[model samples]
Target: MKVINHIREVRQRKGITQIKLAEDLQVTRQTINAIEKNKYNPSLELSLKLAEYLDVPFTSLFYLDKSEENAE
Candidate 1:
């Protein structure tokens, strides 16, 4: 099953621009874009840092879809 995330939603809700978040994380805007679009999954360290940066719980940011898992 694919792992999807609500990173974009949370980022938007906080009014944080991709560039701003990238700058804060010392990553490229393209990297942020990739993450938001689910084309890339951040590392465990980065994930924790992102959750901290967004002021949210890690669990709330990502989850596995049972539907996707069961579809097979």
Candidate 2:
């Protein structure tokens, strides 16, 4: 299953910049960019941190795309 996230949308709506978020989360801006672009899946700890920092529920920020789970 693929991981999908609303990190960018929520961040933008909340007027948070990637750099600021990364700094606040103690991560690199590239890491945030990668996650936002769906090029990387964050660690569980980071994921929780993101949700907390973004002021959103974990389920609201991230989910699995199971549509392809049974495709094989």
lDDT of each: 0.90, 0.95
Best by lDDT: 2
The per-prediction tally of clashing pairs is 0, 0
lDDT (tens digit, per residue) of candidate 2 on 1-72: 899999999999999999999999999999999999999999999999999998899999999988898787
| Model 2 whole-model lDDT (C-alpha atoms) | 0.95
Model 1, position 1, has a per-residue lDDT of 63
**How far off is residue 64 in model 1, in Å?**
1.4
lDDT of 1 by residue, 1-72 (tens): 666789999999999999999999999999999988888888999999999999999999977668966777
TM-score of each: 0.93, 0.92
Where does candidate 1 have its weakest 10-residue lDDT segment? Answer: 63-72
Where is model 2 more than 4 Å wrong at Cα?
70-72
Please state the error at residue 63 of candidate 2 in Å. Answer: 0.3
